[model samples]
Target chain A: MSGKSLDNRRVQKFHWMSRFLSGWAIFRQSFLGKIGLTLLALFALMALCSFIPPLVDPMYQPMAGVDPEISTVTGPSTRHWLGTDFMGRDLLSQLLAGARVAFMVGVSAAFMSVFLGTAIGMIAGYMGKFADTLLMRLADIIMVMPALVVLLMLAALFGQLSIWFIVFFIALFRWPGVSRVIRAQTLSLKHRPFIEAARVAGASHLRIIFRHITPNVLPLSFLYMTFQVTSAIIIEAALAFLGFGDPRTISWGMMLQWVWKTGHMFNAPYWLLPPGICISLITLSFYMLGRAMDEVLDPRLRKEGQTD
Target chain B: MGNGKQTILELDRIVKRYRTKGFFFGAHGQDVIALNEVFIKILRGEIFGLVGESGSGKTTAGRLIVRLEQPDQGKIYLDGRDITGLKGKASKDYSRRVQMIFQDPYQSLNPLLSVFDTISEPLIIHKIGNAEAREDSVWQAMKSVGLSPPHDFAHRYPHQLSGGQRQRVAIAHAMVLKPEFVVADEPTSMLDASMSAQIFNILLEMRRRLKVTFLFITHSLAAARYLCDRIAVMYKGNLMEIGPAEEVLRNPKHPYTQALMDALPKFVHSGGVKRYETLLQAEREVSGYVGCPFFVRCKVARAPKCSREKPPLKKLDDSHSVACFYAEPGIKTRSGGKA
Candidate 1:
């Protein structure tokens, strides 16, 4: 006769990992998650090809487009494709390199924001009192700051920062909104009857937060992540456009900076239009994907479509 | 009253209070006494009914017994072990022995969990068996609660089921572990009259087969009469009367109990006039050595002593207990007579 509970082993079997796997499954089935992953996959393929010389472009040799001598500076042509900038760089090749940078910045910054926001928000929402007030007020302070000014200050202080540095820096401003939403969710979710049920069942605080609250907020974090990626890309573009871009790496915003500085605004529609359109499409894809993911994940977060 | 018949669960001087937000900053928050010096002993294999009005603390007392909420000043003993101080593993082990069925079926069962998952959750939480064995027990539990062809209902979420089916799922969840004592907090109050009756029968069957002791909390005395062996009537957080269900309903002692019986609508043409008594200022006045909580609305209240002293739960017979100073068993109840 074992002097132990028959149910103890069974209860312990319910690990947090099982729920996380289930959450990923649910997100995968979502329409936005599907399209978002697909678009991201395509970008990832392009980014991977960017490392190879011949793979990026068959006609132009590696670093050939950068020189002002190899290609003629002209408006949209059949030979040059998206024509050439004042520096004689291929706008199409520069755009491809920009996509790689966009993907990196967007993804890394979004990951940082979501991870910090979730941790901060979950703690504030679950802990209550002093911790709650402290974190929420911190978020409030960050949320009210002007995004452009903060980026400008950072860029001026640390000239030509690496892509990862910009990613982490931008993420600092990005976390407040996510934290606010997640904290609000944790507040409301904590009061749910099931949460009470779990507590009464002798579930530890950490167990309830990770097993219950975490899964519930995951879809929300994911939906926010998509929007975060979109904003991250735009923010990076804006920084690059303002001449804070790294000289070593080329991006859509860097191309726009070149276009503006060269005084080829009206003359080179080929140079100007490509980067702007790419930026719009990338942002649009994320927003569309986010909305669709929300619709599938949580109906409460789902915004009514135009048809409604 | 057999020698071997054990008391499965007992509450001694249980007091629960909630602090309301203060009117001003740094102001002392007012405490709402949800239960006051309450004591109960639920015998093994018996459906002990706790009947009262909406704000009478029936649910609070139920929650306290199962350790859902800690009592401000009291001790909860399960099978003669003081379990209120239990922590971590010991507390979880205690949870295995004492389970609860909440009032709202829709809110009780997690929306994301399927019928099978909801029923199996307790077993899963308690670490009962392997997956195959757990599934076997789950199907048996579901069948016992009348969820036939368990396979068809296993994958269906709570939103897909009817009110009765959902409550059945809730019942299956509570009884799956075969707990020694279960506190059912108004299990059928949320359902329609017909559905409520079916749910009650299922509860009765589970009680019969499992021999599980129950602290049944409900506002409806009629449901209590149909299910309980002994009934405890409460009012404004005070136990008004406790006796055999048939005796309490057939011949009520407390005036509040009489008022409750009088309020029941009867279609028969009988000229039995009902008297109304304005309950003395007992509404929301929680703290203080304040008199009887029901004195303000008591129909048979006389002297001001009731307003000055809180009545203690006193035993009148081997099986009967009343908390009122003026409660006399011989007195004929005006309403609920021969109808």
Candidate 2:
């Protein structure tokens, strides 16, 4: 806190920061939010440490690094920590690298989908009548198709999908659900007096949609992004387990696939449980994050007697 | 035209109708006539009062003048230039000189916007000035609206302010551009008595300092009497009476106006608050009728004449007009002013 008065820009920034801090205060009280944040932090740390093992020892690399001494799957020991897989690759390093992939696939895909959905929804809602009907019907058409099945068909048609392509398709398939929620939010906001005030203030339609409507709907969009992250990660994991995932990437689903394919599904408990547990926990954490955010974004969801 | 003053805004036979959605597809429900051939002329620098009950189309009329909605069958002239169908640059230009202050202070200001952003919005939209100059304009507007020590309130959001403070911010938002005409639609309806008085005083100050013409739309007769130079009473999309505020409040001519005056609760000690008792206890069914809108509820209405025809505005004096079959030079009541 400076003694001198803050300038206009600083004041504007401070306003948003204060809003966020207050929201954080409310968010911190939710049990789900605390657990979700701690789990996410752990996964983030694991993702960050994924590069360290490969740097210290080449054999600890998740892919293309074989332990010269181990020829078959082994139980946990000082040598490999979690254990060595049938391919002589370290399961712990593979699990850490999988965390990195999960974060990448989840966040990038969720961000892209949310950005697309919010834009389309705001336009469809603000520019009602023809544009609204057309866009909503299109959203309906895309939403009904199962995303995973479509991705499998695409993978079959164009062999060996890249990791980035999977993220892109996940985004493409995932936007309609977000668009529906955002569109509904935008519809409720369209007739609010504030929007009318903006129009009466001589704002162009573009200005009203972007400047006025965007900020109002953005919190909802970001809340949906957390839920979208959960779905994107699950979809990617499913694709990798089904062997449609990018072959070059080391993901938890790919590790599960290796364990199942090598007939170690019953014998290798160490390799099997870690990747499966990691996948489920990461998705659960994101879902919990979304739930807490939903409570934060909508005040009506807060418990009775609570006051801002 | 009544006192040789310039008419800043005129609504010539404005009619606005909204069609309600029917139960089934392709079925059209009744047209809700929000405004029906309503005519008004607001003079430059005068506070014109538009008084009506709820659903009387007063707010709709305000929305029309501000171009929030277009009149179905009329021309709105700003300084004699027809602005009913203004589009593109012309419409944007029209908005620069015309503004509105909405009724609900809590709903009118965007919750996400801070005080500075809300007030400075008009300047930004119109591209009026650079950042520093815009800040100066916002500060000046805030000061004029009594949001002093600009730094203290500039960063505060709408939720942090009380009802009156929010209304002041709303007024500042409307006044920032120094618009020539403003339509304040029941701006103090949601505030407490003292806050309403504060808002009224701010409006008076704005008119005094800026010389901005106002069409003050409200349902409160006392508020209209306090702030308006001229007052027009509306009922069911029809204007019942239009006159100088004092003359109209003191000696109301129309039966509906008399009923409205009769409905005001009088103090026991107040001397001789006359009641005309012009309202019928049982409302007459008026489906598909073309008579005066108030004919169904008027106690003094006559059958075969008042029920058969729609009355046009008839002049009783230089500045007073009423739409009634049997309007007379109203009996003078001892004016015990302000309760």
TM-score of 2: 0.96
Name the weakest run of 10 consecutive residues (lDDT summed) in model 2 chain B. Answer: B330-339
**Model 1, runs deviating above 4 Å:** A1-64, A67-72, A292-308, B1-4, B268-289, B333-339
Per lDDT, the best of the predicted structures is 2
* Tens-digit per-residue lDDT, B1-339, candidate 1: 333678887888888999888877778687888888888888889899999999889998988877777999989888888988888899888888888888888787777666777777778778899877788898899899889988768767777799889988988888888888888899888899999888888888888888888889988888999999998998877788988888888777777787777677666754575533323334433355378777665645544677788888777777777888877657653332111
Clashing pairs in 2: none
RMSD of each: 5.8, 3.2
Structural similarity to truth (TM-score) of each candidate: 0.85, 0.96
TM-score of chain B of each: 0.91, 0.95
Best by TM-score: 2
Model 2: fraction of native contacts = 0.75
lDDT of 2 by residue, B1-339 (tens): 367898889999999999999898878899999888888888999999999899999999999988899889989999999998899999998989999999999999999888988998999999998777888898899999889987789888899999999999999999999999999999999999999998999999999999999999999999999999999999988888999999999989888888898888788945778777788878887677778788788877776677779889988888999998778655542222211
Instruction: Give one digit per residue, the lDDT tens place, for model 1 in A1-308.
Output: 12112333333344334545555565565676677677766767766766654355554432344543454467666546677666556666676777888988898999999999989999999999999999999999998997768878877887777777788977898999899899999999998867776666656788789867897787789879989999999988998899987767888888888888878877878788888988887887788778766656664654454211
Tell me how many residue pairs clash in candidate 2.
0
Would candidate 2 be rated incorrect, acceptable, medium or high by CAPRI criteria?
A: medium
